[model samples]
Target: MSSGTSVPSPGCALTRGRLAGVISDDAGRPPLDAARLAAADPDLLPGLHVEVLDAAPSTNALVAERAHEGAAEGLVLVAEHQTAGRGRLDRTWETPPRSALTFSVLLRPTAPTHSWPWLPLLTGYAVAKALRAAGAEAEVKWPNDVLLGQRKVSGILLERVETASGPAAVVGIGINVGMTADELPVPEAVSLAVAGVEVDRTDLLVDVLASLWEAYTTWQEGGDLAGMRLAESYAAACATLGSEVRVDLPSGEVLTGTATGIDPSGRLLVAHDGGRTAVSAGDVVHVRPV
Candidate 1:
């Protein structure tokens, strides 16, 4: 899946610096050097066309622009930092230079348009699986947050680009790697360092990419059955279930209920005093027991 500038294949004979020159985009994030990052893993997606940049306008925006410019699928846009990095609902995702992992995957799916709603949920599964593989008991929190013992560890944002070829998706992901407690902008936000877990960023990236590629391909190839399986997995891993919560809807209404499980459509199933309501989109906050 290597593209953009011609670079030697992963196993081909080339100098380290020469391999890094594959995506020497001045406007892009500094090269992450995937060769050095990935460990000897059996499952990691080999030969990923990685673009490294020191900082970027936004990984999602950059990848989307590249897709418009004819960038190929599996092209990963990674930023050492993002100047205007954003999350779902236009919230900012901050990262100091080389302090965290901020990246996006450009993918052209073979699935039908109806399957698009499942992308972000599947992305969460990928993060959870990767974190678990790293020896942390990571769990999903409804719509899109990954948590370790009730504290946030990672976030995902999936965007779609309607190309002439089809709907090209840019799945953006960020993990709090090496950021200290003092460096966090929000008091509520915590990092891997703060959580007392040390992990090689490169190794984590490899595992995440491998898991994500598998999840994406599974959904692409008649995995509607597998999607149900994933939804069940997500629900089981989700910390939101069985917790009294309030879902902050974009329409300015707070739906309060006890989160029971996730619906087949990937919406949250919350049982309120009145009845059960399925929320397609919202920010779910766990309510403190009174």
Candidate 2:
């Protein structure tokens, strides 16, 4: 969403130049056509509005600002480059201009407050589902990391904020699209191109957003993870389940265990030596057997 600009409604017709926001400095990265995204084929992004920006510090922060200002649900903010993109535990990642798919969507849920923790989990499922359909072998790591052949290819971060209209959730999604091996920020990260999945970023964005909207609405309507077999579907797409995991909890204590299942509330169920623990938040590492 932009300042001093009238935001268009879902069905309103607006025409924009085909590569309107692409900058020359982003040559190394693929161009994302704001026009294509805003046009967003009739069936895709049904009620959502997309605003593409050349750059931003973080789409999540920007959307949160809009949320505080009473922005409507379904407003999507997308950025070509994020100078201060963030992850779980405040971890930060940077995306070179136009090199990745980065965006945030605003949602005001009808789901019960207790069932809301499953938002990110369901988001991960949506992403992995989309990637699989896009010709990538992708699976969700526990808690919202989308992995390709054991390395992270995408991630979801959800931030909840109170707005005058109601409580709003800003769901941020980032996927490595055009980055090459040398451009990957970490050894454990991979891009679609590097992973050999050739795709148009605009098409990928549309597919991913459509999948997200479907999963989100269904899960929200169910009011709990297990209601419509959400937990079952998530466990199926989750690579973390049945793996040996080492969880670094926020208290500085580590729990090494077998990740058995995901509970309805969305906490990770770990079966460890001393006893079982339900992890609400942690850094999870899938241990490779020696």
Per model, state how many residue pairs clash.
7, 0
Model 2 per-residue lDDT tens digits across residues 73-187: 8877777777889987688978778889988999999777787888999999999999999999999988889999889999888988988888889999999998989889999
Cα shift from native, residue 68, model 2 (Å): 0.5
Q: Which residue pairs clash in candidate 1?
A: 28-53, 29-52, 29-53, 29-54, 30-52, 30-53, 30-54
Clashes of 2: 0
Candidate 2 regions with alpha-carbon error over 4 angstroms: 1-22, 28-30, 224-228, 282-290
Q: Go through the candidates in order and give each one's C-alpha lDDT.
A: 0.74, 0.80
Model 1 Cα lDDT, one tens digit per residue, 156-251? 888889876767999999998777777777876677778777777777777788889888877778566888888877788788889888777655
> Which parts of model 1 are misplaced by more than 4 Å?
1-7, 10-31, 37-43, 282-290
**TM value for model 1:** 0.85
- As a TM-score, model 2 comes out at 0.90
TM-score for every candidate vs. truth? 0.85, 0.90
Winning model by TM-score: 2
